[model samples]
Target chain A: MFDTSTFIRLLPELILLVTALVVIFVDLYARRRTALGLLPGLSIVGLALSFLAVFAQWGTREVVAQTLAADTFAAFFKMVAAVAVILVVLASVRYMRARTRYVGEFYAFLLVATLAVYIAVSARDLITLYLGLETLSIVSYVLTGFLRDDKRSNEAAIKYFLYGAVASAIMLYGFSLLYGVTGTTDLQEIARRLLNGDVLVNMEWLAWPAIVLVTVGFAFKASLVPFHQWAPDAYEGAPTPVTMFLSTVSKATGFAVMARMFLVAMPALQSSWTALLYGLAVLTMTLGNLIALRQTSVKRMLAYSSIAHAGFILMGLVAVTTALGQPFNGLDGVLMYVVAYAFTNAGAFAVVAAVEDGTGGATLDHFAGLVGRAPFLAAAMLIFLLSLAGVPPLAGFAAKLFVFAPVVRQEYYVLAVVALINAVLAAGYYLKVVKQMFFVEEPERAPFAVARSMRWALWLMIIAVFGVGIFMNWFAFMASQGAAGMLGL
Target chain B: MVPLSWYLTVAALLFVLGLYGVLSRRNAVAILMGVELMLNAVNINLIAFWRYTRPDNVAGLVFAIIVLTVAAAEAAVGLALFIALYRLRETVNVDEIDLLKG
Candidate 1:
């Protein structure tokens, strides 16, 4: 029954796997020749090819051997992951070459990370899911410490590894419990068993612990409150490009998996799970914003703000319901919000990377008089900051409107108001960066030079932020379709 | 045949001990050991459930094998990170690696 179409359907993942292998081998042989410059070009081509593959598979939905699926939902995330990886690779080109000796391996790891995201998002079986998640996590740890000799990078990697291992172990234990009770490792099968009221009748008491343990793992990945200790250290310590990847793609991957697992499997426990998420959503936003407001370092502030954004995204999850009629009503908002966030956050971090490269510092003091040093970067940072603050005519505003629409529709007035206030509180820190860039007096040095590749990446992101905002209806429709496809609507 | 409750009880105890180790231990390696203990508990749960529920299917056995492999990989990464930490600060104690604290 396995046909050529099966392989064809997995073209994006296959292309990514081959690209990673090629990049790895190319690094060893390229040496210090002019050929070294071609590595990034090849990686970009690989990402583009995969993006096309996802496009080709856009409307096709099929489960392959009960382990993975080639559905519109997977396609949607594949495109997101592809865009994020491409932007990160573009940002890394000059940055990685300037810092690290192993340029080829950096690009290779980026591709592998993207490949892992595809696998994780497409996984239909629990084993496949775990494998994908671990692959992504491990690669991410390696990427975080790519600057091996730097103490900060090393510390970030270890802290991330320890926290990640413990969290995944806990989540796996919860998975084992679920498999033990339901006697199936397939996600859809687990849902069937639990919701049908046949398998978990006598074992109803076990379900709560299983869900709680699993949420711990997901919360860590999403960097939600109470499990958010790693974000600031990891974001500040890693190379800025890797931080961009972690903040945007890594966070999106976590949300994608979380949405799939909670909405698809064990949805029968919605009442209990939603209540828990309600509390977590509030804690994550409030704590993240309060802590962010006190941060001095710009990078650490962005890290904390990312956590707060995670809380806002969780509001979409809380708005979800499995009442059999309104499928994916809130989920569409989650997908749109994450995609919009990827553009805005990645664009913002790209600016940080550019400034750090120019000034050798990422502190607010170093950012003083940036308007005179680099006018384009200052303007771009303003765009991204305004977008993050949810100003109109920007992607962040559109993202908030889409996600909060569902919450308001569901009559979650308190949650929506809390999120609104956090957004306002968040603007204070974002404005600090803008104030440093625009309002401070000019430094005496020659104008700082922006790398050609870094400039391109920022421009692309600027386009994406404004493009998605202006084309809100089309992207929102695509997100709704992706959400509907995920639920088999 | 061993009772399912007995296996589950031991697994729960192992998991609890692992959580305690992860929480209370200051040394990085010891905390990793705690994580290992927790993963081992999961393996026991998976295998016990498989043998008791349905031995014909190999999914449980397969899942346990994957978990074992991933655990080994995780340990290798963990140790590598610890070594990197030691090279930087001359210590593997988590409390000592506090340079990035807010």
Candidate 2:
């Protein structure tokens, strides 16, 4: 009875696995000079194909024998992950060649990481989730230090590894506690047992520890305040393309897992967890922005800014819990914010990479008079910065508004007001970058040229930022629909 | 049979020791060892829980195995990074690498 049905259901993962192994072989055999060039192309094609396969499974809901779930929520995230990989690959082609030596492994690891994200989103059981998250974390550790000769890269990789390992361990411990209490690892079965109060009444003392440990694990991945010390150093030290991938894809996957676990499986404990999330949201936003203001290095600044944005997303999660006893329409804001962030953050990093390629600069001062030299690059940066600051007529504004509207509806006036204040504080740093780009005089060096590939990615991201910003309603609808599907609404 | 509290207390001690290693050690390799110890503590917890609460469920066992596999992979990559760092900087002192420091 347990034939190839599981493999069939996981067709996308199967294809990706085969492709990753094949890519390794190809990298080993291909000519050294051409390997880097061909490998990214191969990765892009594989990711595209996997995306199509995931789409083919859309609207289908089935438990793949208790380990994985084929559902619309998974399909939606699969599409997002695929798109993120495509963009990262596109942006990486030039950056990797210029900076990194082992391009083959870099591309291969990225593909594997994307596959891990797919698995994480599709996981139906705690074991599968752990396996998937570990896969992603391991590959990312390798990729973070891909520049073997760079000191910064080495340090970043170590810190990331140490933190990630500890977090995973804590998470596993929590999973064990839950298994002890519920006698099941499948999310649905655990939920059923908990709702029936069979486990809750019997093992009430274990619940708080389990919740705290699991929250710590998820918080590390999401880069919440106390656990976020590694993010800035890691982001600044890793290669730019890797930073983009970490901020967007890695962070989004954390949210996906959190939504799946807390919203679906542990809805019974909303009151306890919501308080924790609220504290994290406030601390993450305030600390992230306040520290970012003093940074001179653009990469480090963005790293802190990304942390602040994580806080914003956490606010949406808080809204989802506060508005109702369950995560429902409130999740729409988080989803929309994520989509907007994916575009804007990726675009910002792409522009940073482009500038770095040209001027060998990664500091804010290096961008002085950038507007006079590279108008398009400066313009792209402006759009991304504005969107990030939550300015009107930009995707960021819409996202913030969408999240706050629900909080208002739920009459959480204080939370909404705090979020608004944080948004204003965030503007201070975003504008500093903009001012440096346009107001200062260009240094007396020849202007750097943006690569064709980089230009194409930037243009696409700009269009996405604006398109999502202007048609806010459409995105809100899609996000709400997706959230409903996740909740089985 | 070991009491569940004993297992939990041992796991907790291991985790705290690991945490101390991670925060106090300056050498990257020592820090990695700390991380490994923590991971082992977690594995013990998983097995203990499986035996005590869900004797009928195999998922905890499966998860512990998976966690071991991932820890090994992580160690390989982490050591590679250390090797790379040692080559570049000629030292492994965490405090010395301050290029990206705030």
Winner by TM-score: 1
For model 1, residues A1-489, the per-residue Cα lDDT tens digits are: 668987898889899989989888877777666546888988999999999999987888889767888888888988998999899988887778778888888989999999999999989888999999899999999999999888988989988998899999999999998888888898998899888765634665677799999898888888989999998999999999999999988888888888888878877888888999999999999999999999888888899999999998899889975444563367887888888899999988888888888888788877788899999999999999999888888888888988788888889999999999999999999998899888888668558889898889999999999988999888888987888788766
Instruction: Give a tens-digit lDDT track for model 2, residues A1-489.
Output: 466867777888877887788789988999987787688888888998988888777777878866788887777777878888788888988999898677887888888999899889878788888888888988888888888778788888877887888788778778877877787888888778777877834565686788889988888888899999889988988889999999999999888888888887788888788888889988998899899989999888999999999988987777674233343357888888888998899889888888889888789877888998899999999999999998879999888887887778767788778878888888898888899999988779677788887888888898989998999988887787667667777
Could you estimate the TM-score for every candidate? 0.98, 0.95
Superposed model 1: Cα runs more than 4 Å off? A322-328
Instruction: Compute the interface RMSD for each candidate structure.
Output: 1.0, 1.7
DockQ of each: 0.80, 0.69
TM-score, predicted candidate 2 vs. hidden true structure: 0.95
What lDDT does model 2 reach? 0.84
Best by DockQ: 1
Q: List candidate 2 stretches off by more than 4 Å.
A: A1-8, A200-202, A321-328
Candidate 1 clashing pairs, residues 3+ apart or interchain: none
Can you give the lDDT of residue A278 in candidate 2? Answer: 85
lDDT measured at residue A412 in model 1 versus the true structure, 0 to 100: 91
